[model samples]
Target: MAIRDQSYQRYDGPVRTGRSWPVIGWSEFRAYWRFWRTKLTIFAVWLLPLMYALLVLVEAALMEPGQLGADGPGHSHLNLFVSTQLFALALVYIARGCGIVSDDLRHGTLQLYFSKPIDRIDYMAGKFYTLVLLGVVSVFAPAVLLAGLRTAFFVQSDMLAEIVVLHLQTLVLLAIAIALLAAVVLGLSSLTRRTGWAVLGWIAILIVPLIVHAVGAVAADISPWDRLLSLHGLVGLAGDALMGGADAMPEWMPRIVPFAAIGALIGAGFAALNWRLSHLEKIT
Candidate 1:
């Protein structure tokens, strides 16, 4: 039985069989829901989104008469949409994502989780979905619901198709924004064990760049489109897509440039954050 004993000793640690896409996806969703249920109360989770939806409804109500449609040719749906998107979506992402990973580390949760058979990717997947869901509840769901309400209350044949198209466009735009926000927040949180620092660092990473960009804009005579590197500018561009306006950009640059650049920053930020966190060894 010496051979049998030797064989048993050969593999001492937990064995990992990496998961497939479908399994990973479902696991992510399920884990996210579980965390959501536990962390957020019924009222906070449901009420917050509903309240944001009402804000959009109020904005629709306040819009000038006959201004909902595209017939003006000087139409400005993009501005309103971008503003609402930023206001509605930013809080949820900032709160949950900024705290998630850092809290795990500070409270010794990650060690407990790692002690189980779970992988870093799985852990990150769960956190990512949680942030995505929060964004949907706040920004996406509210935007669509409010848009539908607007279309129902004030129907205009000329603008209805455009509004509908804009609504569809919002889904894609919000998805990118939410993904970027969630990924960067999660990655940053993972870098530090202090939740407060994680959040502040996130804000600094986001805001400081824009502050620098703003100074550069004036000193260098930079075009507004170039300022899209600023946090507010990128947020505004995302909003503009929904509102159908982007006057700040140079007329020569294609409309897609701002949106694309914002998306790239978010994507790159997420990758860098995740790479940093994933490589981190536990501090005893």
Candidate 2:
């Protein structure tokens, strides 16, 4: 019996160093886009903005010069689209974020990740970046493009300044919405190793609030503060405040409540994520 000597040989390669988070984020981002379903969903969602823009153009073409006032059909349509699209954005968040961390845990990939030069924060940040980018592409980018297109082709000269201001406000609101939703989904993902459980948790978090809010609305003894119980309602209120539509919120419900609720949700999510990851790190 002859045994051949086989020894490990060290090969020279680039030593990975600081700020590998972007590389991690980029890899995930590219991987997601490779899936046909993801590509299709993104295309469909982005088409919405174009459809709204076309509606604005059609309305502008058909209406008389002075008839299309500041509060015209185009304006109303844009506002409605922005408000109604939150649910779609939520779906995007769930689809992309629910499995990100849980998959790592389920497949025992966390050990491999931690064995590398990456810190837990960097790993979390990488996942967070991917989610945030997906949210922006699915929701924020489209809305901004729609606003710009409307301004370029449909807005009246006198309304340009006002429309631009509204667009900026919408951008801010969309950014906040994406950030908070991403945090919630990532936190949920960290809490479970099964992607299905994480998804179910996200659904419950979103839907249960709506159900409670609906029941409160129908009850005769409902308190004004009960409105805050609805996460969806709070998001709407926050959007209203951002767009200078504070009159839409209840007189008793202060404008700050919605912003505060969003802040609290984000904070709680981060805390949960930290706790879960820290425990996992200790175990490893």
Top-lDDT candidate index: 2
Provide the overall lDDT of each model, using Cα atoms, as 2-decimal numbers.
0.62, 0.75
Q: Which residue segments of model 1 deviate by more than 4 Å?
A: 1-75, 115-117, 154-156, 209-222, 238-249, 252-256
Residue runs of model 2 more than 4 Å from their true location after superposition: 1-16, 70-79, 154-156, 281-283
Residue 215, model 2: lDDT of 82
Q: Count the backbone clashes (under 3 Å) in each candidate.
A: 5, 0
Location of the lowest summed lDDT over 10 successive residues in candidate 2: 70-79
Cα displacement (angstroms), candidate 2, residue 228, comes to 2.5
For model 2, what is the alpha-carbon lDDT of residue 236?
67
TM-score per prediction, in order, is 0.67, 0.86
Residue 158's lDDT within candidate 2 is 73
